[model samples]
Target: MTTVVVADDQGLVREGLELVLTARGCDVVGVAADGREAVEVVRRTLPDVVLMDVRMPVMDGIAATGEITRSGLPSRVLVLTTYDLDAYVYGALRAGADGFLLKATPPDRLVAGIDTVAAGEALLAPSLTRRLIEHHVRGPAPVVGRPAALAGLTEREHEVFLLIAQGLANDEIAEALVVSSATVKTHVNRILAKLGTRSRVELVVLAYESGAVRPGGA
Candidate 1:
């Protein structure tokens, strides 16, 4: 079973998620009402996925996610917020959240998202990708030239990087590059290693923030 830690300031939200997740056969290992407690629970339980809330007392979800990521824990975080356009979404992803989902998301989708992240797959939906980039990417776009972090990538890896930032699946990238999915996966792994990113969502945030990809795909 996929193990999960649910963190929300509201008690009802945590209980509801646990109920739904448990009903779906997920292992709701732990729950927390604050980011600090959430981090402690995560460190102790080391669940497969953490359902983090953006707004929390003590420490915000973004900081908690950053600490968890920098600690090199195997657990992945999937941020849950009440608003799709929450201001903290970009920060959470930059802090190593594997994906973001609104509280209104159906229980089935939420459970499926946990499974995806537990399986080491990115749960970044295309719509979330567009909204995040469009909303947060402002001021002078850095897409004009390559970001220094990407300089280490080989030509193929760079292609994969850009495609990943564009929210393309491995199969889609393979098709676009006229390569096999295995090849794409290999390229993706290399890109992730070179960029020191835990997942594609982080790379996506990197690409957008570094101006590697412009809003509106310009």
Candidate 2:
């Protein structure tokens, strides 16, 4: 069974999630009332996934996510946010959260999100994609020149990276590029390695932050 830590300040939400996860056959290894406790428990339990709420006392999810990721812990984080357009949530994602889900997500999708993260795939909700494009990618940010991290990618890999940032699945990318699924997967693997990114979500963050792709631009 997938193991998880549910971290949220609301006791009722925490309890409800624990119940739902357990019913779904996941092991709720720990529950934390805030981000600091979440980090501590994660360090101790090393669960497969962390269901983290963005706002918490003592520490917010963004800081906690940074700490967890910087520590290179095995556990992947899945942020929980009430607002789809919360700018801070993007900060958390950039801090290395595997993905995010709205607090209002249905129970099945919630369970599936945890499972997806546990399986080492980034899980950006479709609505979350729109928010990122509309809120973060629509405006101009300071460009320090094309990020050096992308210099190693070949033309094909660069193309794959843009499609990934566009929220296309691997199979879809394969179809769009007229490449085999295996070829697309190889390109993705190379892209992840070259970018030093742990998942597609980080790749998306890099794409936007580096201005490799922009909203409403080719």
RMSD per model, one decimal: 4.4, 4.5
Between which residue pairs do clashes occur in model 2? none
User: Candidate 2 lDDT, tens digit per residue, 1-218?
Assistant: 99999999999999999999999999999999988999999999999999999889999988989999999999999998897765765797789888888888899888878886787777787677756666665577738667887888999999999988887766678899999967987898889998888777677767887878776552
Per-model TM values vs. the true structure: 0.69, 0.71
Candidate 1 residue lDDT tens string, 129-152? 777666657545555666777888
Winner by TM-score: 2
lDDT of each: 0.84, 0.85
What's the lDDT for residue 48 in model 1?
97
Clashing residue pairs in all predictions, respectively, total 2, 0
